[model samples]
Target: MNTVTRAHLCEAVYQEVGLSRNESSALVESILAEICDELVAGHTVKISSFGTFSVREKGGRIGRNPKTGEEVPIAPRRVLSFRASHVLKDHINHAPASGDNDADGTR
Candidate 1:
């Protein structure tokens, strides 16, 4: 599947829900800002039936320079991860997309 960008995502959602582009963009921005704030605060955001977003910290570690075959020190960083809820996972895993059926209509 092709990845959806923020601008296109806002447009698509607006079309579906009948919201204006401005409203959709603002709403998407607010949601993203809130998610970022929660991550910065070290809190996990769990959207029921969707997934959970959490921030994880990684300590500094050793690294390698493949070109020179030299070891280097890597800085620590924070990463965000999402864990899909069982319901979401089940739907995505078992449900076929539209127009997926054959001539016999057997998916």
Candidate 2:
């Protein structure tokens, strides 16, 4: 139920890479900016063992208003989506929960 922020990522990099806080922050920011730029340029971004980020084009359609029962036109737009890789999915699915024991009953 916790959210991971850019600061969290920067801190993680700083801790794991022996980088200064400012350098870690800049590195994380640079990577995120590159990903955003690629997506904005209509290119898909794929990270091995992580996930793929892509933009999808959706056609305009008619939608109904829930309150007044009126029909409305919905504009066509591009949406960003993420598809997790199998490695990532398996890791998430098999990850041990807090306070849980392993198969051999060792925490």
Candidate 3:
């Protein structure tokens, strides 16, 4: 699997905006920190055409252990959830332009 890291974002920003590597890294970190701060405050962060990130409160529940067949209490916690926007979903579902040709190289 291909995973993108902060470095990847920093590089992209640096290439696109002609910013120094350090500045690009700082920009990426600041944006991420802002998103996290809002989520921690129980606010949704919505980036149009991207997705929405929100925190949900889960109630404590009893769950059974498969191996021991014993009931266990599951502690409740706040979980972060992301819902992709329609544009983002469509982008993911479509094939890239480079993949549109047949094996014979016909467009």
C-alpha TM-scores of all predictions: 0.75, 0.84, 0.86
Give the whole-model CA lDDT for all candidates, comma-separated: 0.85, 0.88, 0.89
Which ten residues in a row are the worst by lDDT in model 2? 98-107
Among these predicted structures, which one has the highest lDDT? 3
lDDT of 3 by residue, 59-100 (tens): 999999999999999999999999999999999899776864
Please tell me which model should have the higher lDDT, number 2 or number 3: 3
Measure candidate 1: CA RMSD. Answer: 5.1
* Predicted structure 2, TM vs. truth: 0.84
Give the clash count for each candidate. Answer: 0, 0, 0
lDDT ranking, best first: 3, 2, 1
Q: What would the per-residue lDDT of candidate 1 be over residues 13-106, giving only the tens digit for each residue?
A: 7877888889999999999999889999989999999999998998999999999989999999988999999999998888576645542332
The 10-residue segment of model 3 with minimum total lDDT is 98-107
Q: Which candidate do you rate higher for TM-score, 2 or 3?
A: 3
Which candidate ranks first by TM-score, i.e. highest?
A: 3
Give Cα distance to truth, residue 104, candidate 2, Å: 26
lDDT of 3 at 30: 99
Q: Which ten residues in a row are the worst by lDDT in model 1?
A: 98-107
Which parts of model 3 are misplaced by more than 4 Å?
Answer: 99-107
* True-structure RMSD for candidate 3: 5.2
